[model samples]
Target: MGTKEQLLCLLESNRERYVSGEKLAEAIGVSRNAVWKAVNALRAEGYEIDAVTNKGYALSQENDLLSPQGIERFLPRDHPFNLIVRKLVDSTNDEARRRAIEGAPEGTVVVAEGQTAGKGRRGKEFFSPTATGIYLSIVLRPALQADRAQYLTTAAAVACAQAIEHVAGKQASIKWVNDIYCNGKKVAGILTEGAVDMESGCFDHAVLGIGVNVKPPAEGFPAPLGDIAGSVCDADEKALRNRLVAEVLDRFWGLYRHLPDRSFYDEYRRRCFLLGEPIVITRDESRVRARAVDLTEDFKLVVELPDKTRLELPYGEVSTAHA
Candidate 1:
């Protein structure tokens, strides 16, 4: 662990009481002055530490640090992902795409506290007010056929669901394609973009972007979306933000290592709410009413027509499979 992380860990493990500078110095093999310096550094980093004259320092238990360095301390050592925690941005997905063009390594994460231009599935406007949401994106370079790329979206959806459950103790559900639902409302969304490599018949790189609404005003949502949207926290942003990032990334990394697994397809479908619902989807200048028959792993929508005949619709059509 780095010096900053070590100091933070020490403070966190003994949060109940102050750890004297002399004792801390003895334990960490640093001088008392050095311990004092470390404490100052943490304070500078936005950690609310109370410094008592002779008693040393104590981290305020109620202070939840969601800063980049603070989040880094909670991650696994030598984690195979580059995590970028931003205070603000135009959009995490847009930033990740820019990074991909610059040849950023796979698993490079771009997370922001707010997005000025956050968007949702099907070209819907995303509301990401400042310090009120978790907007995140990740770059991935998987050598898989385009035919197999559909599973990547489902994999990421499951990752987000699993992450939310672990971090917030909320049982999140997936609404087909890549939307996470909790408590009868939306919680998060993911978008995937890729570069096709025809020569090698594989995708050179893919970027999966996720935006989780951690907080907003307590009045529910705004205007048209008020009835359709909700937040994880109507009061606490810090706790929700940090936990969402840690859990989402942790789950994403696990499924990403396996890439496009069909076994997870069943589990993902079970958590879906899109299938079996009466819906009218616009496909190529024609709107068709079909019952969602089943969610196929190939990114095809099995929607049964009025005659009960099942027709598989490619994900590219039907606007977006998400509800």
Candidate 2:
């Protein structure tokens, strides 16, 4: 742990009361001046730390700041993953790809405050602004063969839905493949991309990118997305971000360790939004209007078309005619 993290741990450990600067400096083996600098830095990062003349400092319980220190406190004491927090990035998924190519271990996570080029399925642009959402990507090297890789996206959707429910205390549902919804509006999206070794026919690594609208933009969403886009919650920004990230990693890692089995299938299907609903699937120049009937074992959407035929569509943009 660095000086800032050490100081944060001390304050977080004693969040209810003041911890003397002298004692903090002694515990962390730093001078009082260094402690003051650390406090100032933390304050700049949105931590609400109190300082008085006689009393040293007390960290407010609602010190909702998104940082390595804040996230680490909520994570297990001895986590094995490498967590990279960035102020800005083109995309967390892109960053994870760069890291994976350079041999970043499985479970490495990249989180950014903002994304300049956020992405969604079918090459769509996800509306990502600064500081009001959760943008993160996780790197995984599963032992399964390349054909089974699609399950990762399914697992990611389930993990994200569960995490959102756990943190926001609200129910969340999922669209066919990667979109998560709350109250019938799109609140989050998942994009899963994989790199394969041609000769071995196995995946080199896979990156799962997730973006959730935790808070609304000051000006609200753009005209194109304004009608469909929505936030998962309007709670304290930093506290929600920290808890959501930790919970997602915890839930994802647990399901990932048992991949190809897809034990989350039952829960995932239960939370699906399009089951037995009239829908349209668009691909290139083709479009199919159908009734979504079920989600299959392989994560495909089973639908009944106007021709009275059952079709299992693997991927497409599903939208209700009524919407």
Candidate 3:
């Protein structure tokens, strides 16, 4: 750990409690000036640290910056994952994919404060404006067939919904395969891309990209998304982003250890916002109106169409007027 991380650990371990600069320097074996500089750096990164003239420094319960130290504090000391945070990126998913191609191991994470070219499902451009949203992607190498890659997206949806609900104190629901909704509007999206080994019919690696609207952009969303796009909370943006990211990674890893099973299916079905609701599924030029009934153990969506036909679809662009 570097000086800033060491300082962060000390301050975080004693959250909202005063820890003198002298004590921090002594604990980290750094000069007092180094501690002061580290504190200033953390503050610049959006950490809410309070410095008292005589007493010490106190870390607030909430921090806005997505510090690796802050995130690691919630994980094990030897957490196997490799995490990378960027001030800006074209897209975390793209970056993770490039790294994966270069032999990046599973559980490698790429997060950006802003994405210039973030993507949604079906090649749609996800609107990622500045630091108000979380744009993250994780690299995974699951020992499964390429056909089952959708399971990663399903797993991410469950993980994201649970994490948002837990950290934001708001109810979150899954919309079929890739969307998360809160307060009757879409709040998050998941995009899972797989790199397949053609000869083996297996996935070499998968990049799961996630974007959550934690707070609205300064001028709000574009006119095209005015009706559906929305944010999850108005609380501290940095705090929510850090907590949501950490919780999603932790929870997803726990569920992933037992994959190719139905452990996460029931919970996913329970939180699905589209369940029992009328929806329209668009694939190419075909549009089908159906009532989403349930999700199968294999992550397929079961819907009852208008003509009383039951169909199972693995992918589609979902829209509904129910909300």
- Per residue, candidate 3 scores C-alpha lDDT tens digits across 1-323 of 89998998798778758988999999999999999999999888777899889889988766666667667767766677898988889989999999999999998999888999999887899998876888899999988898888788888889999898888888998888889999989999999998889999988999999999999888889988999899988744546677678888898888888888858988888887787889988878987678888787887888898888998887777777454
Clash totals for all candidate models: 0, 0, 1
Winning candidate number (TM-score): 2
Q: lDDT tens digits, residues 187-260, model 2?
A: 99999888999999888999999999988888899997989999987744445687788888888888998877
Model-by-model lDDT, in order?
0.75, 0.85, 0.85
Reference-based TM-score of each model: 0.82, 0.94, 0.92
Q: In what order do the candidates fall by lDDT, top score first?
A: 2, 3, 1
Worst 10 residues of 3 by lDDT: 234-243
Candidate 2 accuracy as TM-score: 0.94
Residue clash pairs of candidate 3: 64-238
lDDT of 1 by residue, 11-129 (tens): 87686799888888887877878777888888886678988888878888656656555455557777777877776788788889899989999889888867888866667667887
The parts of candidate 3 lying over 4 Å away from their true place are 44-48, 60-62, 235-238, 321-323
